[model samples]
Target: MALSEQGRHALRHPPRWHWLLLLLILPIVAVSLLFEGWTTHEVDGARTRRACTSPIPRSADNGAPVLRVTGAGAETVQMPLRTAALTFDGGPDPVWTPRILDLLRARHAHATFFLYGTQAARHPDLVRRIHDEGHEIGSYTYTGGDLGSASAVRSQLELSLTQTALAGAASVNTRLLRLPHTTTADTMCGGEWSAARRASDDGYLLVAATARSRKPPLGVVRQYSHSALGYQEATKLLDDPEVGRFTTVTSGLGRPSLTAPASLLQRLQGNALIWTQSLGHRFARSMTWALGIAGGLGILRLVLLACLARVHVRRQRRHRSGAPWLREVNDPVTVLVPAHNEEAGVEATLRSLLASTHRDLQIIVIDDGSTDRTAEIARGVGDPRVTVVQQPNSGKPGALGTGLSYARCDIIVMIDADTVFEPDALHRLIQPLADPTIGAVSGNTKVGNRSRLLGRWQHLEYVLGFNLDRRMFEVLECMPTVPGAIGAFRRDALTAIGGISDDTLAEDTDLTMALWRVGRRVVYEERAVAWTEVPSTFSQLWRQRYRWCYGTLQSMWKHRHAVFEVGPAGRFGRRGLTYLALFQIVLPLFAPVVDVFALYGVCFGDTGQAVGVWLAFLAVQLVTAAYALRLDHERLRDLWALPLQLFVYRQLLYLVVIQSVVTALLGTRLKWHRMHRSGTANQHLLREPAPQPSGLASK
Candidate 1:
């Protein structure tokens, strides 16, 4: 019962919306990065400003006069002698802001507070306190980003978001603006001066400090940040006899107050800002948790693969070592090869079966309306034991059901039309059925064509992913899919489960689960190896995997109620289904989100940490894959493709899962995807002679 390669291209070619949705993610991420201040330039030449550096001086010697914009343009306002306006920048800090505010309150003096939109939105209570205490509030821009070097959109957002945050907090918008990094009025040069002019054009009063003097100066705005030095300087100024009065920026100039009632639009904008801020915070926190869970699950899977794989290897060795003494049953086994347009490999498949060491064999090749030489090829095999059955274009499941009806023996072995078994594969495969309790057994299926990179990748997946997982699944007592490539089933068990079911695309997985629900145990036989031709190209691979993934999903859902059942059914349901859901469905879905976050970190956040974490995960995977290859008796050199697979090949698998889920959610029916056969299954066999049978005589 080989996987049909027909209509594979259609299944693999995703809908336009799937690609458009993927393309749309880039722009959304770009916009998010921009808003997060990734695109903003720093204040001090190309370097980001860490904190407020030097305090603004307070004297006429500061060179250029600070411009106070009015309806008539701009005017330089000079303070009256000994009248200094104390100003604080970069706060509403949770700790320092409160200390500065308390200091000003105790001194009975007023100062203007320049607020960053981010800090303000985070602590609106502090913003209200600043306004209620009679301290003037001025915009320092959102995130305190340098507007001069920022993109136009970022610059506008920086200014407008500050206003929105201020409005949301205090129900007021400030007309006074303080350009970050500008100290004394004379410091406004180049980009700073340009930014100031732009601010003035927007009806903002550009405030800067006067030069420092030996004595407290009059009619100057003394700018400071909410820091220890700023607090100390403000305290010293308050005690200076030369500073006759301390007041807000506007009050010092005898102009209107900075605070005003926010308009309807401003209030609405403020509310929206608050909502977005909250949502952003929640999203960030959730992503952090998601990354943590993903890392944890990934590490856990690796550990299981490495540890349980060792156990599986030990168990296999012990079983094989005892096989010589075990009671041998030369049961007349019926091998069913279900075919559909597999003419290229049909001869090799029949020839392999004829060469099997198992005697008293009955081989039936069901050609399900293959519009090729599949039936002719089977009949030409010349083996008297081989029987060719022709039927209409029924699916693999139907063909398998039809073959089972014609089967003459109790022990039935089903092999894909393109699969070539090792000489002893059938013999070892049927050994497990000798145990009356074991109703079915899955054989080791390896990719036969490994000449190309894609083929090599699939080969690694067989050893590292599928084989390692089967080892763990066997130990866990939740063996899910006895692959159709080479699986042996008892006739009674197949009949009990109603033969092969066509209700799901994954007939193999569906039939396996049904057997479990009926209290039949399915096991794995690693010694029984079968070589099956895998899809060579990405398109063919996508189609095969997409159908496989979609079918598995359908099968899981069909048997979902088994989770609530008792005994082995519940055990398989809970353990197998849970593993599938978390690792298969949920993990793949979150993988793209993880990649997006990694990109965000590289572009806007912390690149070092992101790269470090990614490398660590890759290292763990490499180690686990190495162990899996060793367990499967594969070469370590093949592991070079493991890391590369993580980047490209793994993403394809993830997309397959995603598309399968999307299709299932939409209740869309998918046809069986068939791979074009190249008859590569016997290529390896042709190079090696068939091994002679041992212990038992060949009939």
Candidate 2:
């Protein structure tokens, strides 16, 4: 059925909201990365912190911790009374800050707290408590980073963001600034003094701790953290008989409070910032869990494939070891070639089949309304065994059905018009069918046009991702796909399912599952090699994969009831279908999130860990791919581009799976999309004698 104009337009240019949603994903991910970075102290952290580099100037009275700077000069400020100003540095910590506040409450002390923006943002209630208890607020330079070591922009952001965090948490902004990793006014040397001067220009009164020796008798300004040691020090000082009343810096200096109530607009902006940070935190946390699960599942699948492949190989060796397991099948067979505008490769396909080592053959070419000379090219092969059937513009299943009507032989082999089979491929593909219980045999499908990087990637995927999994599937007796490029079926079993039906875009998958439903064993034949052309460009690959994925989903849903049925159907349903659902459908959905989090880890989090995991994952894949390649008798050099494939090729496949899932869920009908054949499937054959038909078998 033809889609409506709206549907066509919608498919071509999806609704604005769809694009808007896509656009939102990046910004949302970026914000989430930023939030996680800030929470983890990556934005302004101890890793980038430094200590005071030079001594205090002589013009500034050195012993005093607080510096009072005017437009003309700078001087130290001290309490007129025999008073000590108690200031806490670093946290508004969740546990320590609360405990310290309790001690201050008990003593009726109003001190100063220089807050880390991260801690304040994380524990806003503590920030509010400090302000409400009459304790003065001061900036602790965001993540307690040293201002002298940081760039000018870093210094400003640290100060402003801290002010905003305070405004959001307590509705107040402070003018008192304390550079982290710097202590005692005398220690403010070189770059530290310059940074202090810069803060003074912004109306910030720079505060440091007084020298420990002089401060004990002179009632010095003390610096502490919201920590156990800081609490113990504070308690002892509170009980000191020599020290006068414990109070805030401003109060002891006989000056007004440095903190002022934030403007309404400032408060709103600050609150928004706070809310965004919290939301990002939640998003990051969720993605982290999702990424871990996805990563684990991915690794688990590779391990399963590797282990099961070994079992599959051993089983094969055992089978052939005794007496050629299922005796060599020399039965007459009918080969069905479905084509639509496949002129470029129809001749090569027909020639390859005609030259089959299994001599007795009947080849039927069903040309479904080709604008090009596909039937002509096929007929040009000039073999009595070849028969070309032309039909109106119908899909692949239709073409297959038309060809099936002409299949006089009991064994039916279907090969796409774009595939070139090795001489022994057909003979080997059918040997498994000799076992009466086996209904279908999946041949090894290799990418032939692998001279280019894109082709190499596809070749790797064919050997590693698809073929390796098939080995495992065969071992588990749950094989899901028999490639359209080369698959064999018993005529009785093929006919039992009412021949081919256009039930799904992936007729091969649908047909294979149908065979399994009727208690037919589908097995893989790695020795049965056929070379087919995979899409060479990203767009071409996308269309081909999109159709395949969508059709697979439809077939899975169609055969969903098989899960409850007993025997072969139940095994395939439970194992093959479940695996497809979990690994293919569900896991790929989380890929974008996983990919973003991976980038976050590399850029803003632990880069070594991130890169190490990625390299490890790639290394495992490479090892498995090498094993698979050796099993298929291919060279190992193809793995040189495997790393690049992970970064580029994998993302494209992820997107394809995502879009296909979305299209399936939307109930969109995916019309059969035929790829343009470039006759590249016979690339290996070209390396053979020009007169003889051969594929990779010649090599």
Candidate 3:
């Protein structure tokens, strides 16, 4: 195509990809949360935190526990006088570290506390408390891992991360080090000795406990876990007669402070890490709870629909047999078809109406300024009962008003030009109106071109979402809409509402709400079936749903005052409108939480739990879909597409809803999108068997 044609095509299909970008927010946050979870979470085994009793080489000082080894030579020192340097190893634990600090505070003694970085980040207060009391801090390799067993990279990360954690907690970096899973200089042997030499090369004073058999008067460096047993042993050592004084390693050795001030840049980075860890934890925790609520709400909706459908079937059957209000309906009904460039399926729609089992009909086709053969096609259909009325392009509501003026019968039926009714659909549809109280009846709308995957997904939605939902709505007497594909309305009710209107894009929904507000009843007739041509392409489906969603929002807002009215209108407002807001509007807006958290669980949480919950939700949906199919007399084979729909088609629908909501909030007008029909309305009509007569059996 030329550049001009490309430009025209671009204008025709304006970029809508940007609108769906909101859906990416959840996944991005989930990924960041998973990353934080991975980096911050550490699980050290029991053996890694245990004290090693291995023997050391004969080069270093036999009694001293502080070593500064360089090259092939090693040097060691002990505190002069009969004094011992008190040191606590493994952690500045939230529980035991605070208790140990209290014990030291009571005795007026100072000790070095080796902090596990993971614990330090979580309990920074404890690290600060250890430093603020004129004490010392040292690295226990973040998670208390045995450096002898760690790789070179692991060893470096363990030490550096501990430094960062200390920097964030107390704004200082420590050179004093205590290797976990070991006690004295004698135990720092083999690989432990190698790791010790590497640490000494980096200027870390390898601190260890005095030999087990040695006395504290010989200047001991204590080793202890931030645990109950360690607290007990440290208390005993503090009161020991062999120990003259309890002082920090630097103080006992008469050297400068072991901890140096951290740079501003390192402090900022450490603080950022702490902030992100906290954020990720809170976000994941909230998402989990919210996903559970969503799951529960979804299950509640399905359960209610299933139970209410049963009640509806029983009530309808009971009315048919014994209720005096219900009588056989043989009244003449007028059918209105609003056409706007629907040339593809106009003839099929007309012929289907003519072939209806209820033969006494007046069919009027209103041409809404179509720049196509829509008007000519209706006129060409040679039927005495068919009438074609031409009008200017004033939109769908204007065309419906024109057709309603031409309708001569007391009962009126409205349908789309791309819909074909079943032979007995019109008869069964009007039968519900025999009660005189029911002002409108909704018919089952099925997808005609259901051979493709997209069509199959829509077919499932019609059965479960629209048809099953209508059953519950009818039982509750809060039916929100009688779809335009097939619906019957009392002439008086239509006139009272000023006939079909352009007040909202969903004229059908607007009209139905008007009926409810006027003390008139609306109901669903599942036996009344109509096959309508649905959009075959994704672009067409998006545009079509965008209009429907936006229009429904408008109708809801327009009739929002009904909640304050009396009788039927209040019932619908409280029940129907509230239901739509919670389930349709609000729930859909938060539906992405399910997918986002499910991904997070799989990435950083329990895979089985996530998969189990997802599968459980899917199983519930499948069971509900099966029941809906049974009610509609549809085969179960179509359910194969239901699972796939959750991944792709369902996501598209929610995105359209979100975009439509944003557009509605902005008060932007949405004109009707003229769908490209394939004229396949009659294909399903011929291929599928006539719907079997439904009974009041427990479907």
Candidate 4:
């Protein structure tokens, strides 16, 4: 089962996550079918338009009863107004519209076609044909389509009339108009009614579609153009003279007409159909809940995994005192630092690396199109060990690739310009390269400063969530990410994977997975730690984490099939894939919901249900927090923010997942949302912002 080059290329590329989201897709499609089936049933048996507009002939003696409402002083009273004709609103699509017009043409019909301005204009020949066919042409208003302000509404209607005139409407002065979507009965359109009054002054009459259809005394014929195609057959049946009931408008030139409602099963089926009309809404809601619950489960699983990882790491640390995992070695390492708009941070990063005890390293700072003095500041560091390369802003992947091309050393260490490495971090990171079996080593990243509450929370997160759990993956040789901040890879190992693809947002993660796919082992060095700055503001944090989470998803989605291959290497690959899917993919999606849903429960007065679930979720979070603390030696106080993080921090991850999922689905533009640098180059990273004077809102 070996892959050819072409097959490998195809296999190496990750299918869109939507393919996996097919997990939810089947259920969604099923739900849609149920609703659609119900709609088809109701439309087949439901009432059709009972009335329409035709010339009454001003002098003709008509028997139509015109019930009137009049206001009086002593006997003043309010009464319901009756309507004779039903109106169809919004549309002029060619597909079903022509059929409707043809049906009307066959019957020598004259129902007002309330046409959308754009549609009417686009299909003017059809509008001209509608007029040519002797139908009463009406306006659904231009952007009756747009539910906006009074002025906006007027503008929409006026545009519609103008377009209708342009479309060869027999007369733009036609008084008939139907509001978009909602009826005059809905509250949102009361303002529309005022707009309607202004329209009335122009001789306009507001119309509503009252699903009633019947034959008149003089062989009067009418037809409707429904928004959907499925409704066409049903409307035809409803208007059938043989099996259907006849309906008449009270104001029309006819005796008062009353039609019976359809059968009991039809009513039941009708209610279901109406609800089914909102199938998209229902599916969206269901998916939202599924996403929430899935997120909660993902987080919970991450917690357990992190705890287990920490326990394993401690055991390894105690037993392997020979320091075998940290065996120091000398191999000339070329450190690639991709810089973009990093004038504020690049110098410090170079300064930190130059200060490292690892003397055999050559630092290449690739400035990826910085408008700022990023390149100048990088060279300004004045270290012979540092080399500054300039290029257009081709992005990190391109920058890293450029740096790698120039690299001469056997090992390549990719570091972010924003990160500040400790003196020994570089030395310890490459130590694992001494073992021929180890092709790559990933370093732990610590928050440089955590004075702000947000920073502290992120600090806690790195310790508990990533570093602690990465320990287990390291031992399993299934490590999913060799972070861009500090990852050491054998130059040959990297080149063997055909270098990194700039197309992905998370190139580091992509490279790591690629290495594993080629039977190269990646290990994490807990002792090799770099301190990096994180976003301080809520918006900044959201954007940063969103990119990271989404990018990781993209990478995972890209390399999904590698998990659990059969040959020793393939088996290892499969294990890695399973670990990521379970820990990274499923866990993050599920954990937040455990927190959010529990909160929702409390709001609904389900105290018992809320408390039970809340405690269980909190316990998982605490386990993760405790484990992160053990790895990074941060305080337990930071763990208390976990619940609050759910409300504020984790929701952003969901948004990112949703955004990424949509992008994958629709093939949206994928560009890296760069993280902004905060402090002066000479200054250390800022502490997280202080808790609000009033903490409740921040909480």
CA RMSD of all predictions: 5.6, 3.6, 5.2, 14.8
**Between 2 and 4, whose lDDT is larger?**
2
lDDT of 1 by residue, 266-285 (tens): 98889777666655555555
The alpha-carbon lDDT assigned to residue 365 of candidate 1 equals 95
**What is the C-alpha RMSD, rounded to one decimal, of candidate 4?**
14.8
User: Candidate 3's residue-wise lDDT over 1-699, tens digit each?
Assistant: 111111111123434554557646665576657645554442232225334445455667476788887775578887766787777876667788889889999999898887778677767788888888989888888766678777788788788888888888889899999887777776777677778888988889988887767775677777777899999998988889877888888888899988999999879877875666666767777877888888899999999999998898888777767862367788999999999998889999999899999999999999999999999999999998999999998877788899998889999999999998888999989988887788999998988888899999999999999999999999898999999899999999898877876777778888999999998999998888888999899999998898788778888888898989889999999999999999989888877666776776776666787789889889999999999898888889999999899999998888877887776665455567768987875776678755665654565
Local distance difference test, per candidate? Answer: 0.79, 0.82, 0.82, 0.60
Candidate 1: clashing pairs of residues: 4-674, 5-674, 5-675, 6-674, 57-210, 79-219, 82-218, 83-218
- TM-score of decoy 2: 0.92
Clash pairs, candidate 2, are 54-189
Candidate 3 or 4, higher TM-score? 3
Error (Å) of candidate 2 at residue 533 is 1.5
Query: Once all C-alphas are superposed, what RMSD does model 3 give against the true structure?
Result: 5.2
TM-score of each: 0.85, 0.92, 0.88, 0.57
Q: Which runs of model 3 end up more than 4 angstroms from their true locations?
A: 1-24, 40-100, 123-126, 141-162, 177-203, 206-241, 323-325, 688-693
lDDT of 2 at 558: 81
